[model samples]
Target: MKKRLPLIFTSVLSLSVLLAGCGTTAKTGSTATPTTQATAAATTAATPAPKKDAEPFTVSLRHIQIGDAQKFRKAILDDVVKKTEGEIPGLKFELDGVEDQVNRFTKLPAEMAANNPPKIFDLFGGTGDALKFAKAGRLLDLTPIITELGIKDKFVNLSQFSLDGKVYGLPIGGSSEGFYYNVPMFEKYGIKPPTTWDELTAAAETLKKNGITPIAMGSKGAWVPNMLVNTLMGRYAGPDIVNQIPAGTKKWSDPEVVAALTTFQDWEKKGYFTKGELGLEYPDMLNQFVTGKAGMMFDGSWRSSVFKDPAQAKDLTNKVSYIALPGVANGKGDQTAINGNYSNGYGFSSSLKDNELKAVKAFIKNLYNEDMQVRGLLEDNLLPSMKLSDAAVGKVTDPIVKQVLESYKKAGSVFSHFDSTVPSDVYKETESQLQKLIAGKATPQEMADAIQKVQDAAIAKK
Candidate 1:
């Protein structure tokens, strides 16, 4: 079965504000001495005029900063909302928080199809998301806005959110996927951060023997497991394969791609992953690692925030370290290339009223500036999507965040996640087929073939 991405947009900012004015009149021809009249005139001149009353209005915003793991991100968003509302009179933001997957795969799509999406909402970039919505004329074109804001060149990359000459969404931050290990657990087991495939597997075997889940995983939302598989695909098939498949130069069923799936399947058979991962949610994976039930987890750099906050990570605070996945023995292409993504962000509806458009503009100005981007880096462990000065990047002191930056610096190259490279049909097939592969109901080759078929059909349509 082919999967379609119906979800259209992800909005980034929202706010509510209402301002009213009041004033008192002075009596005409008041009898007073010159000194008293002069004093009154000075007083009157010093008093600021009251503002005009504004009609209350709402700009509906959809977001994915939900759960304990997302509290830091939510805090940054809350502050932005307050500032935006303060600047935009009579504007009220109706925020709707949803799980990332639900908002991306369910609600947003339906609303988009109905041509009634929120004024602003969370969105992803790629053929399936921002691009698709742009084609349907459902998303607001932000090219002029960014230019007007004088931020057109500040972004590191806007390719994902741009189509031809117009821009649609704006990425909030950048992230790279890799291994986050329990520092104490590795020390206790006499394991060093692996620099090669053999060492990685050896460490996993050691942990499994010691009754620790080697890799914390949650597959209930297939996207969780797909993260590791995507990196693995990068290793075996090469980074370019992501773009190649969509461009018809390569197929998902290519042997190297199938081998990547087999690698994951082999891990499953050897009991390297959390037992019953298929039944667990994303948060469960984090809980397993932070609680010391697992020795390692393959996750994004954004997760470092959880370990930095004691309220969220508890005893695990300051006890976690991140590293790039080691080079595979037979890996092809630039083996040191790591997965980096700047595809997720917020977008706006094209059908906004004049006031709503003003509100959206104010939201963008408030949220995507230097201060907020720096706040995201310091508070949420999210890498800046826009360019930061050397002084700004120098502000990073967190050990885990440092490691993330180091890994990126050391990488030979960077590749994007396939979810952002391929069309929704093909990406969705990979997710479902991966679950089937994990359950032992489908062979790695079978999974690859299924994904390739979907890819072919999608390309034909294009």
Candidate 2:
């Protein structure tokens, strides 16, 4: 979700058509074939033998692995490989591992620029960085191939992935951050999911009274704290405020931001979070919630997929349910202003060989085919970027998916999170200040002032 510079298209016609329909299939008939003509044979004969293959070349893919890859090997990866192979007849795929989110941000970019870079990379966070690469002529202009394949309409949220009206990446799925609670625990305590800020606090108080932790949060990652802050801002000041902060039209020291931090600090003081959460890792915190040691968790939709996976989380699936973050009662913000964004997807490198480019387009088109999209949703609990009939989603039992889709349908607008849109330096500083504020080491005013100073400096740099 980190924001990078907006990409500029080298040629308007080259990338403009990439942002069209969300269900059109790619045309396969017109794709160029790899053959050695007299002129090509002359060059090919002189090329190093190590770099040449007898058939269409294979593309190396670097994928971001968030959970247990072994579990999804057969279910997701293997299937994708088989499909890609069938789509791009003679082409092959070589897989590489990206262990976690941090690696995707810090290591993947440098790796991509090296000689013999991976042809396809799974971009994490947002398409901003991918767009930057595209603008720099590092990513292929997929518009022509996508149009030729007639699959331009198969992508969803194309507008979000476009820079200066040109599309640079494809959105695979979407996600939202919300609260997941234990239904049996709620039933046992005769407590209901919170719908408003007052109700949320009361629920936490009730849980405390019953000797249960109110929330299971992991603060070691720093981003977790930012998530809570952004959600609180959405609840109090509305989604538009986030946009204003990034555009320099509003200061971070606004009273609304102060109120949000005050509320978070107040909750921390009241012992709403798990004890010693600051020292706990994200996996440990998630395990605490899944094992029934905690009553609720604040996380994104990806976690919901975990619960639904019988092999991964059999115990937690049947007992879980999700609800939107509690709204501020009669507040300015709408109840549906949930924090969300498109998930990781595919992008092509501009430096791809002619044959490799065709193979890449064919593979992407096949991946977004209706059958595959439905399979991805039903098997992976991933909402497809391509359009699907309601029946295709009928098998998804995860409560969070339904809630997230509904939230998307009703969202008046959506905005990226603070850490996601702010400069890296400002984002890191804000995260540190937020941690300090939560630890009772910094006052709300002090935190607000620190954020304001960083924002001012960032603006001055511009």
The lDDT per prediction is: 0.90, 0.71
Once superposed on the true structure, which residue ranges of model 2 sit more than 4 Å away at CA? 1-53, 69-74, 86-90, 112-117, 125-128, 394-398, 409-412
Kindly list the per-residue Cα lDDT of model 1 for residues 351-458, writing each as its tens digit.
989999999998999889888899999989999999999999999998988999998899999999888888877888889999999899999999999888999899
Q: Residue 344: error of model 2 in Å? A: 2.7
TM-score of each: 0.89, 0.80
Q: What would the per-residue lDDT of candidate 2 be over residues 205-281, giving only the tens digit for each residue?
A: 88889988989988877777677788888777778776677688876788787888888888899888988877977
Error at 82, model 1, angstroms:
1.0
Give lDDT: candidate 1, residue 12. Answer: 12
lDDT of 2: 0.71
> Residue 102 error for model 2, in Å?
2.1
Worst 10 residues of 1 by lDDT: 11-20
Model 2, residue 407: what's the lDDT?
Answer: 70
Total clashing pairs for each candidate: 13, 11
